[model samples]
Target: MRIAAITRDRPPHTKHTAEVVNANTVVSISFFAAFCPVSSRRFPAIGFERHSDEAKNKGNDFVAWNSLISSFASIGNASGAKNAFDAMPGWTIVSWNALLDAYARKGQQLRRMESLLDAMPEWNVVSWTIMLKAFTKEGQIDSAVAVFDSMQERSLISWTIFLQAYAARSGHLAQARNVFERMPQHDAVSCNVMLVAFAQAADPASAKRVFDSMRQWTDVSWISLLAAFARNGNLEGAKNTFDTSPFRNLLLSTAMLQAFAQSGHIDQAQAFFESMPEWDLVAWNTLLTAFAQAGDLYSALPVFRKMPVKDIVSWTSLLRACSRDPAAASIVFHSMPQRDIVAWTSILEIYSQAGELGAARSTFDRMPELDTICWTAMIFACSRSSAGEQALELYALMQMEGWNPNGVTCLNVLAACAHLGLVDRCQGFLGSMILDHGLSPGIEHISCAIDLLGRMGRLEQAEELLRAMPFSPDAAAIRALLSSSRTHRDVDRARRRARSSCSSLATIPLLSNAML
Candidate 1:
């Protein structure tokens, strides 16, 4: 019963059981004794006891001794395994190998593992493999290579692990290719790793070269090349790779579908999606997201209704898809089996974005909880709908409710004051952004305050404020100045020309080959 209890591997519960386990007593010895009625050779991997020294002197329990050593080693207790080894009256090659394995697996002690390996009386392919993996785990690349060169024999797995170390390192592509060219044995995994490495580096031409040289291609080969082309924005090359591949699985199809969607080839994205022999929920969601991004709810709405399973992600995609249409968003909201905070938040944003302030307020009132983002979104919604005063009121209520405003929330409050041309409130919010919230006002926040000054016909104060900014004044601040100049119609043409030139330089993109 004690042997069964130990072998079951449940957590220690009672005091008696904990004492039995801690003592490492006859419970471990009994594990080997719990054999089948027919044969001791068929003993289960439970605990065991060492018999009298007389039995050890007689050499009758060699098999049981070796099994106990291996079992403890397998459990990662190096000290216990070593103690079991010291208890052995004789040793075999298997005992040495087991002890080596235990030492190798002891975490992050590479120097100790190397010393242990040096102490082994004899070594085999298994010993070399263990050493290779230990070195690989520590990222000791030079030591791994030295071990690889000294090996009298190498298996396919060993060779592949050696090559992968090079492929996994940055700026070591030449080394990886050199090793691949010299491989005496070629297998699919090793070949695919090189291909995938180049693909991950966004080198589609090099990847294709490797692909063409393969004696045969796996589905992984096809997927790697497809992903490489997609990442490089070679849509035509991606399609060609897809069409010529011998097989098409869901993963490859999804890769192509996403590539087309990101490149604004919505028509091709839809086509690839429909061509898949099987459609998982991810595929459906991807299609919905593509259509939604194109703002073509005419296609997305029908698909959402036909899905056999609708998780929160599916509904959220549809809600975000139909953001331009509050009525459609509301219909999806009412149909949810249950809604989480994200769902409630999305509906609130949809109503807010469409300028339905009363509808937004009703939804906000129904919310079971509120966070800073919810408060900010409502504030932004009010300003967008020309209710600047109401937006300010909500900001006050948010503060009273013990919700400290974040950078975005503070910025939205400033924008509301700007819309209403409330100069005092604008200055107060800008100061509060720095001192109260510990957030330095970014250029956009200052731009908003300057707009408030411009709208109030304080052109000179706005100009003075722009000159006082710690960083270079951006185009928005200059445009604020221009707007005030238009209000006055007294600024010189040369001043307007100078401001326009600054805006032009800031707007034009500086590309990599600008000197050319």
Candidate 2:
């Protein structure tokens, strides 16, 4: 009998044929044995041993042993679960599966799971599925496919997971669709995955087709389709879908509100928000974002004040709305209950945009942690203020702090070098951007380099760079060269540049004429 079935009213001693047994003693031991593994507080080694002794005395069955293993596994104590499994005189496939799950949940133990799978006397479909899931979770898609192919039998869950693996990748939508079509059956879950995938890709037409084909619709199906329309900027389609939904859930209502906001229909968004029976934090934030997007700070402030509860996003949204007034933005920043990196970066941008270099630097220094965005913003601020030397210094410091320069970071750095007339440094930085960082230099980057070269009187090199540029040089590049030519009194080169500019751009004619 299970220890849990025992009652206090039962006799302390019960007669069993020729022998008398102590029922209360048995109950006490068995109860602790089953309960110790699941206790909130960790038991000492002696406590575990005592429980094991009790179970052994009672000739504990497989169910009790499996329960013990699972309880330990549930708490993420893989070693404890292993000890329980080893202590058992014998184990069933269920016991082995529990141990495998312990390892799987611990993660980064794929090889250990593989070894255990090999050692098992036998495994069922559950075993294979667990291994497949482990592979997928580890991002070993190719290996997961190999395992799936080897499975003699696959469950619906296995097939769905396989589809999701492909769907989650950006360029693998085709493969995901093929899997969906090949499945022996489809559920709302599988259909929703494909619908969301297409929606994220901004292919609303395909998403609609999938939605129509579904045998049944879930709330997620409605929301995904609504989101698809919003993503595509089809506000009218979003409204039609919302009106048609039989259930007007809070989640669906919030999605529709977002659709109106995304399309710049602030009045409609406000109206829709007012109409909702309930509002969640996400809904409130969405309404606030609408006013911020329209630069309607006056409208956003009242909504922010009215919100009963405010989170970091709520505070950040209000900070963004105050972008035009740096003093007001500073007030908001100081008033935030807690500030995350986004909040910190927003305040930094406000100061930098106002050309307040001293205040910007102070804010940058006060940041407890720095990310790539924060670093780039500070560097750009320096470059814009013509503090080229300081910007370069920060760039070097950023690299030392293990933040790699992104494309925007590279652009700002090159501009700094140009402002300081560091021609050789600018050329080297441009090369690093391409070869070291694996970034494709755009036209703006090339223009900065050409301007630097022109400023340094390396006209021959500047002209060579312009000719060899992969992108057609814009007016700015031509003007930089023309200005340099006139400064050096190179009439012949100025005339040649004017003729070339006239052929490419109509607007360039006026600037070229002025330069000549």
Candidate 3:
């Protein structure tokens, strides 16, 4: 048993059991003297029986119960886990934790999770931590925080989990700091969690403060801080973080390369890429994504061609970059080994952006699995290309295909109706937004509607919709109406709306290349 446990990587629990049996005189003798079964091999992984009925009956013995439950939980079968827990005539702390963990992981009902805790009759730090994690996953931040404060005993795990919850909520950096300040003990994991939270919350300075406060650090903490800097577009700061680290891992290197790429320092990014002794798929993807973002699709070509092995992400990145340049994108698309849905979607999006409606339609027809994104892209491209009739036809066909049109698809339909002077069609789309689809119109959706109304010379109705909007109008919508009014010879309405837009918001000067 001891050798098998060791081979199976359960040393801690096995050793603990050994100490208990060895400390007892009679139990140790009886344990060895009993009819002990011997296995043919030291460990069983590849050829192990997969829980046959006979094997399961034999596995009801005390030794295998915990392992069985753990194995089931690890595989993510909450139903099977509950069955195992119920089958056990007696329960242990380990078994309870496994069951509760399965529930938390599967995101079962919170009440169901609480029922498991209540049935325990006695609880420990592990049980509380699981509950905290469940609440955090469900976005019940207040409940998670309340549960933490109410715990008579809290550990490093509890503190780290709570801080993570705060960070997940937008603009809650201050809450994370408050939790970190109150923790009785701060370990590397705890510090690293806070750093990641602040970094992702768009506060690199807070992330840095937590990182600097750590008395000792791990590779995780180092990489977390570096990622924060990278996300904030602080290329020099990210580089400095990497240089200061005592140990650098693959993730840090990738982060630094991506940061440099985003900060428009392509040369620095290339330097880091060249310096790596060993490169993984992630490294290649990072470089490809960087070049794609810079609108430099040609640079990714050499990397794509010379890659030893390519995966979905690698192909997707190349295809995404190609979307910006039709000529280059066509070359990449043709050379693909086997195109996935993402590859086709990328090509469709490119044609949409480039106003190649015919090509987009061709790709859409060729796709074996035309998902919602593919349909939406095809329609969106038609709308963008000013082919209102084609876009409307595609929209109707999408519905006929039993695919529910989402907000993005609706927005495009509105754009098509507005551009084509189909006022009745525009009204029908708006009605669907509220009555059929049950989607609350966002600013972008409202903007499309306003553009539609403005184009029809209904300036008064457009202004009313702007005022009636739940959220404030964006600059683009206001400016579109104002500019359209000027073209329609409604100079007074145009000037008034323009002045209101300028005064109501800090409107940036419209770029000359903007589509409007």
Candidate 4:
């Protein structure tokens, strides 16, 4: 049957012309059916399955098989993509690339990608680029560089990806610039990456230099530069860029609105928002954020009511604005049509900050999903309440639930351990942060550890830690050690710490006098 005839009965909107001229080729039908909007959404995998079966019965059409794999991959059905790959009569380079792309998009499957790359019959630029992206996504920038270096030929995309990998890291802008300079070519994307890097570094001068050097300007080019100025609090620069732009789209207009809102020009922001020819959800949210940041709920509420459609950000922004009044925030929280983790966490933080532990715990319990920040917030609340035992219990429960504690969570956990004088537990948590989570203990963590050691009469170990910690002992760390020395009556150690504190410019003269 002709491909057109097969799809002629499909809805007019779903009908697409196929380029394949052969009447017997199943590949065309497979591509059309797999992507046909109506069938893809309504039947999903079923349509692919039917096409695959027909292709198998008619002949072993690798193109049909590859099409099915790609369709499955696009929807993030890695398992389905793999199944189609396994069923393929013959695998082509495209087949391997399709499967690799599926796994890359699935994320956190680096090991699988490695094994697949090793097993591939050969590597192409596409395959290598996919692997480069997978490493970058996983924050393995060094590995991504190694992959880039190993490639005999690098495409502009590969170079851009390599540039972005460096740019994304704080304090690596020099390296990103080096990569950009060395690139065989520069695209709008690579330039924007540098633009954002400088913007985030609060260097609009450098960002503008890069912007001026661009040979061709895209909308993103304009927005990135405008945003750079906005971020640096140069509202005048942002306005000039907006006014001179060849076109004014919603996104560009929203960026200007954000510049005004962020710079505390609320009056300008409101006026600019009103003047916009049309507004997207983002522009509305930006205005709400302005009032929320300024603590002007009186103004924020009206904007919230005026929005045509409310997204999670819209609700969260308003919820944040009502933070001072937990009762009002709670009312808004309950009224939200949908509550995401951010909203739930915000409400929990409000209650926790208000010293309503019962309400905080209740809100935490009611949350359908909990991310690292949410878990950290609740643990912090318990820690601050001096419920050290309860905080430790929650920390244990957080681990049992398979949530890995981040640095902030570790800080709270260490503080609780210190309050309870659990030296052994404190040491273990510190060690695990390094070994399991791969997090180096910040000075705050070390201070808590020192404090715990001192409270438990391990003054010598506390002193040793103070001297041995990679960070120069801060005021808190020294005070923790000195306080413990006084408690333990280690006069010599106290004097040493006092002198050391003065020399380090973290002087605690009152403590030093008390110690003497």
Candidate 5:
């Protein structure tokens, strides 16, 4: 059937046109169906399916069925490919390979791939590699190694696959090197892949060893090694590698700047910035992040204003830095080109910190959507600003709207209850933590509860609750009780309880060391 199609193009025979060709060879048939033009009257899809069915009727010849399955797989219809595999009367090596390839694309079909492999009458190198690659991609490295062990002929491809798999997992760096050493033929790619793996694992020593061992090093190898040094917080090593290089590349330089910024060497980072022959957006952002980390929001402002372009991270970093300084917080907040939840939350925190709950509430009310962090930020802001009533209201609304409170949220809400003298409401909030959220109360939550009880003159119950807790009382809890007692003039009782709390705390080094 393929011959007829080839012959027709060479010599125009009256009987040898595409019209006369039988759709018996499904491989050619499915391929033609995918690319061939359709008449206006006939639906292209229906014609394609009809040709596909004719191709399938060829009794699962490895050549024909492989092509048919590939046609369906190319269109991202895995179920259709599965159906085509099922209809095959019998299978050959090519046919099984095609089916396995289809199943590997859909990660959810690992069981199906395994079942097909188990039922196969014989195995080949291609079959084993397919299974190994599937397991490696799914992060099942142990299973991939097991398949490699079972292979009778170990090829370089097989060795490289396992090496790449270990490198990708990061935790298996030693095993990745073992495979690289054992490979009989070391190609450029094999060395490069190992270098990348070591780089990602933050082992510059191993990466440098691979770099030195390579007979030929490409631009890719240099970038990979430089990136490793950057990620491992080795800016000096990265700079040394960059300086000795015959070729200068922007990516390598950018990696060095990023490393310096991340490690908190702002002066060194600025020096690198000035050393750059030219600056790009990435370099600018690196400098911006350095200033943010240093808590020098004033220095970050000029960089933010001068950037040729800005992304979400740029805006968020500046906003967060501004949040720490109340005077500039609102200015930066209003000047943002685009605001994400992080930007909005930073502003909310600023207002909360400055004791302007009205502005903080206004910001919260204006937010387009409230994520968990946003809710937590707003709750904390109000709690600290002495607007506990507003904080409680927001907490109730959060629950009614189906937003689950996390540990931070629970701590903030408990603090609000303590600050507002909401004694009865505190018990209900505690019940909700156990019943609805199923979160165990941590020291922060317990401390807030103790403070609430002590402030309301329920000293006996608070002491009992403190004793009943699995963990001993924390410094904050003891201090809250003492403060409440001193205010109420219960000096005798306060002194004894204080002594007992201090004695209990001595068993833990951190608690005992902390000055109250």
Candidate 6:
């Protein structure tokens, strides 16, 4: 149960990235069974691998093979793990479990995991639980149920894993709740999973109800409810939830840090960050992002300079801090020891916002590489400078370079077309956005498209487009349609436009006159 040391000296186990205590716990029990009293000094692993060779663990004639097997399994190299396991002169139940963990790391390798389980000389409670977890991971509820029925025995760990699987499957809420109710043993993890499921489904109140009902809570329970409240924009509720936690772990602290930072409580965020006993790169980068997002350059710059480590995130945060000040941003950018695609885009956005097309263009051209966001920034950069033609050129070049345009990029392209009064080109871009890029036309893109249609005296088509939009016509879309209706002075269309604009702006008392 004391797995903290097992995963120590290695990166924390992120469920998405690696297995947790389970792999190492099993390894500790079984793998070391082969060789005891082995020295822990490691030798280099053979072949191309990022991992150092595990501890040579030589015990004279009997070498301990478990550490090597565990290391291979942790990295999800089933082949390497198996090779090590097979080369072993003997096997233990823990060794079999470690192999299963290795195979289960990748959910797609489920069939192989099943086969490996079948080949096990004998099975233990851990072995069966491992198999249950494998099915649970793949979200195969019915198959997991089949295994459960056939299970001669089960543990709380297996029971909890099964309960958690229901939450992972979106439509199985009732089933998940039912499983939670049926549990003879009540544990915080199983309870927290249900709470997190409710939170993700945008039912923070339900999460709260669950939290209140818990006889005893874990750190995860408090953190889940705190995050849920914050995510739902109940900042006051989140703070209250944070206050009630019996203890604070890193995950809880980071969650509170983010909640405070995002809600614009910079001082609270700083206080929380300073209060933490330890910090990770994410924690540092998060604080930097908080200041950058608030445009607190004075605060952000010092933090940037003071950070003991700086990665792409740190650099990008610094650039974002000065995004509104092109010259300052460029100064920070040029002084960077390194520049990646994000760093390029951050400075590009600054120039684009300032409408310094030349500077933005230079930044774009010099980028070592460009992804969709970078290319989109270039198009938006040109859109601001009355250089619709140039923006179109960038859009074309973006496609030529094989970067698929996103919805935001399509919005920029449509804006360029509107500025140039290229109704035909706007139509072409809209077609490409929907048919080629598969982007849904949002309000911004719709507004630009409508304006382009109107400029060509195609008032009827513009009105039709607005009416056909999937979303309700926003103020911009409404305005574009109204502008076109008046330009062509089609009486019927103008009257209809006036009525709709009035309805859309009904709450804004003075805007009715402007719309009419």
User: Model 1, 1-516: lDDT tens per residue?
Assistant: 111211122232332211111212322232223211325424344443442233345453545555565555445566766777677665554555566655655546565565655555455555566666666666879877877787777766667778888888887888998888888977777888898888777789999988988899988899889878877888888889989988878877887787788678988888878878988888888888888777677888887888888788788878888889999888988988888888888889989889998999899989989998889889988888889999999999999999988888878888888888789889988888888888888889888888888778777777778778898877776666665655666356226434444544532222111212
Locate the minimum summed-lDDT window of 10 residues in model 6. Answer: 1-10
Instruction: In model 2, state the lDDT of residue 439.
Output: 88
Residues 389-420 of candidate 4: C-alpha lDDT, one tens digit per residue: 88889988998989998899999999888888
Instruction: lDDT winner between 1 and 2, please give it.
Output: 2
Candidate achieving the largest lDDT: 4
Report the candidate with higher TM-score, 2 versus 3.
2
If both were scored by TM-score, which would come out higher, candidate 1 or candidate 5? 5
Instruction: TM-score each candidate.
Output: 0.52, 0.74, 0.68, 0.67, 0.55, 0.70
Could you tell me how far off, in angstroms, the CA of residue 411 lies in candidate 6 after the best superposition?
1.3
Pairs of residues at least 3 apart in sequence or in different chains that clash in candidate 5: 26-55
Write the residue-wise lDDT of candidate 2 on 420-505 in tens digits: 88999999988998788888888889988888887788988988898989988898888787777767777677777677767656
If the candidates were sorted by their lDDT against the true structure, best first, what order would they fall in? 4, 2, 6, 5, 3, 1
What does candidate 6 score on TM? 0.70
Least lDDT summed over 10 consecutive residues: which range in candidate 1? Answer: 15-24
- Kindly report which residue stretches of model 1 are placed more than 4 angstroms away from their true locations once superposed: 1-249, 399-407, 434-443, 467-475, 493-516
Give all candidate RMSDs, comma-separated.
13.9, 11.0, 10.1, 9.9, 12.4, 9.6
Evaluated with TM-score, which candidate comes out highest? Answer: 2
Clashing pairs in 1: 28-47, 28-48, 29-48, 29-49, 30-48, 31-46, 31-47, 31-48
Clashing pairs in 4: none
**Tens digit of per-residue lDDT, candidate 6, span 1-516:** 112211123222222211122334654443233222233523345542432233233421112455566666655577888887776556555566777777875457776775675566555556656666677877777767766665666766767778877888887888888888887876676788888887667568989888888899877788889888877878888889888787767878888898888788899899989999988888888899999998889999888888889898898898899977888897889888888877888898889989999988988888888899998888998888889999998888888988888888888888888898888888887877778888778888888888778768898888899889888888777776666666666656766666666776532432333345
- Model 3 scores a TM of 0.68
Q: Can you write out model 5's per-residue Cα lDDT over 229-301, one digit (the tens) per residue?
A: 8778887888787777776777667777877787778888889888988888878888998898777888898
